[model samples]
Target: MPRIRSSPNSSLPNPNAPPITTTTISTTTIHTNTTVDPAAAAVAGFFNNLLNKIPLPRWAIYTIFACGALLILLICLCICKKCCCKGKKKKRQKKTDEKINLNGVNGKTTTALVQPDVTDVDYGATKEKQRGKFLYSLEYKAAQSELIVGIKQANSLKAMDLGGTSDPYVKVYILPDKSRTCETKVFRNTLNPVFNEQFTFQISKSSLLNSTAVMQVFDFNRFSKHNIIGELRLQLCDVDWNHVIEEWQDLAGPAKFEEENLGEICFSLRYVPTAGKLTVVILEAKNMKSMDIGGSSDPYVKVQLALDKRKWKKRKTSIKKKTLNPYYNESFTFDVSFEQIQRVNLVISVWDHDAMTRNDAMGKIFLGCDASGNQLRHWADMLSNPRRPVAQWHNLLSAEQVNSTLTLKKKIPLASKLPF
Candidate 1:
């Protein structure tokens, strides 16, 4: 016989109390000697039921924890993104305000301001002003025989017609190198004109030769004693002199000489120390008949002496037409003060007024005194004529003559030295 115990929570037999099974039921006997602890069984039964109700795997619990962490990180990132966007928006707004303030202070309008193009104004007036300190904007154009440069103010401000005080002057600077700055004045105007003015600069070949090699312009007012004005650069290049001459050849054609062989002319001077008179003997090789000097109405030769290599002392001598033979001769006597002159250089150039040309008949001669006046050294070129003839003429003086006259053996001593 088996005995069973019951729990108070449910009507179930406790296993710890006893075991009951129906094996054979023919003859059965009941025995009640076993005891069971109900309190412990109830607790154990509660735990077993809880475990069965909540059946969770180890991997599922770990997955839930990881998911919770990811959700928390996502929430933090969203908050940071919002904060950064707000900050950037505030900074951009501040910059915009600053830009607006700057524009307002400068008196700048929202509308587009029409600026003046400086290329429209006259370059002549501007060029003159550029020689001074005034800043100028210039545009240049080169033609067949003319060069034009235009200039105007760089700013678009209406020319103010301020009275005498606002006398505007244009200055131009001729800058050859880093060391030299030559300035020239171009134009002056008291009243401001509505339209830009144009000035013309006319330069012949001779004038162009005297002009500066390079030119620049600047504003004079801007170049105060305390400050220097900005410089505008200009370049002059490719000067064709032959083309210029050809353009003006019609006006100058009649003056050209027609001589085939222009004879050579040479001279020797002897200074008399005792009398203070210089004796000059003229030398000519060919007959004056062949030299057709363009119908010379004023056919004369002028002899000039340079005292200090600076200013010339002049002497005039007339050449008689057809009076002398192929070999001509003339003499001249002049008084020179030795004290006033350190040395005298003689230059004899031939002039034909009708032909409008001057030919260098001979080179320079230096005159000084020795005792006898016979020891005067004549530094004359031995060539038959001037080596560099202007027209189609050849020199007749031989090399030996040039060398012999240039040496000391042919020098003549002066009888007496002049006072000054």
Candidate 2:
């Protein structure tokens, strides 16, 4: 009986279940499950398939990487080649422009033989056509002292005085203490005169060292009885030879420069008027390497003196590499006396085997004497001292006794006042 009663509600709603409400309730629950886009899914599937199914050999991977690197290198090389080619083209254009510019300029051309022997050049040419008409003055000062002289012009006419007379040549005189003297010119011009032509004097360092001992200028052709036309006085201070030697030592390092198996270098001393005696020394540096000759043969040193713009003396000596050190310490000496000399020029050279090939060093010195017997010399040291006194002339005297019966004209002073 009980089993029959419970079966009554199996197919139908029970009447006691709170009126058996038939309302339907709808509910939606959101669960956050990661959703993949179609594109992303496809990419993932592609990678999975590749990693899982496609088995690439190590050698194949290496080969592919190497090929990619080679391709990149080829691209870089191509870029470099293009850049280099462009650069070369630009350089060629620049060269062409320079050549055009050079062609447009007025220039004189000189051809010289390679490594030719040292030769002297005369300032005065016998022919008037070869003579130029330029004059130069050089001054130096040191420690409140001054040295002044006329610089000789190359290939030029001799300097002239105010009256158009040729001036005396200037010379440099050096003392044993390394002090110097400046020379004076006899002819006086109204300060600087205008010349029709131009000239240049060449001086180098080696020659300068030798002649720095003394320097002077003089006027050889005096229209008036007075011999001195212009005088330059130089005082030199702070010319530390020790410092120069120290600098040379620093430059040369510990290397010893000495000539081996070579005979003593010789020099001839000569006298110039209005200039004093000069002692010259010549020494050669040896034991040099082949490269020291500047990659050429026929290396040599030259020495010279210049008088005015028209006179010069030259001296030279051959260099032996086997006897030269990498450092140069060779030197030369000459005893030159100046009876009335004015200007002195010194030049040195290193010769190359090729025709007309030479490297040179030069210098100048000046000397002068005043009525007070004060001597003046000029060189680089003069630039520091400028207070030195120049030479002055005294009143001319009559050699003969004046007769009481005859009245004589008073002698006029001819020379200009000395410039201190």
Candidate 3:
């Protein structure tokens, strides 16, 4: 008969816990006297019992022991792999959760949309999760040839600087036509902000049906360049034009570079290296965007030479009334040295006049594509051939985003040899 035995002098592993199962080898408790795994010891005992019953040889018994040991090691390895996989899965989950939870500027927690895996294939380099959200309404009035949008509020914006919160602002434009860009006022520090602002763009019914509304969220920085947070794009024709449609949409990664084709701007460039003067003339814009209450736009040119002070070149064209294709023929001169031209960039912007509100940017081009690629070619060509007027047409771009709004030729440094 198989006899079971227990050690009367042994103490419980935990005094408060119930008794656990242990292996009994004849007259001894194998669990207490040895550190070997209970399951492994049990397997050994089973093998011994089988050998005794069948009268197996010592070498065969040793072979069974080796197989049992290898099985135990395989089990341990499998358990370790499972545990490692589970730990990795939990870590990934935690990171995804952090991306969705946003702490508000006022110490209140904010939230965002479905988090996507950020990788080099995602936004290219940084793993910065996409954030910020806002509520908006859209309506198109065919009778008035207008597209009206109401920007209501924003929430849980991501901070772009060490200050820990961002100064948030909104810029809206009708795609394929950058002749007009409408924007909201900057809300300082607070991630949760109320805008409650309405904007109207004068686009004809035919053009409005094919237009897409591109709204970009940006962090306003006083001393540095404003950073783009995210963008929301929607086809204007897809919305029900007859009624006001309001929805809370999450800001998505900006994809403005492809086919946004926001029309074009044409201007002339003449650089006189002898006089150290760069003269830029805004001739007119073809297929421009319209921004107005009056079926047409009151457009003007805004020029700025990004210099040491970043001070405005302090020159702009008078507002031309009621036309998408506004003819300015306005000339602006910059007193710049040949060397200064390489380091400096020109920001030529067209804006819509609004007496009641801040003027809205229609579209922009830069002498250096580093800013906006719209006018980089004209600037490069003028420098390539000295003492000659270089005129060209530039495709208007929305601005910088997850994807650049324009395809720009690299800004080659002016021929190292100065024209002078």
TM per candidate: 0.23, 0.20, 0.36
Model number with the top lDDT: 3
**lDDT by residue (tens digit), candidate 3, 132-168:** 6778989878789888888888787777767778887
Prediction 3 TM-score vs. true = 0.36
Candidate 1, which segments miss by more than 4 Å at Cα?
A: 1-262, 285-299, 322-328, 339-342, 355-420
Q: Could you tell me the TM-score of candidate 2?
A: 0.20
Ranking, TM-score, top scorer first:
3, 1, 2
lDDT of 2 by residue, 200-297 (tens): 12223343343432322334431222233232222323344332111100001111321122211222222322344443334333322232344423
Top candidate by TM-score: 3
Model 1 residue 144 lDDT?
Answer: 36
Residue 232 error, candidate 1, Å = 47
Relative to the true structure, candidate 1 reaches a TM of 0.23
lDDT, each prediction: 0.39, 0.36, 0.70
RMSD of 1: 29.0
Model 1 backbone overlap count: 52
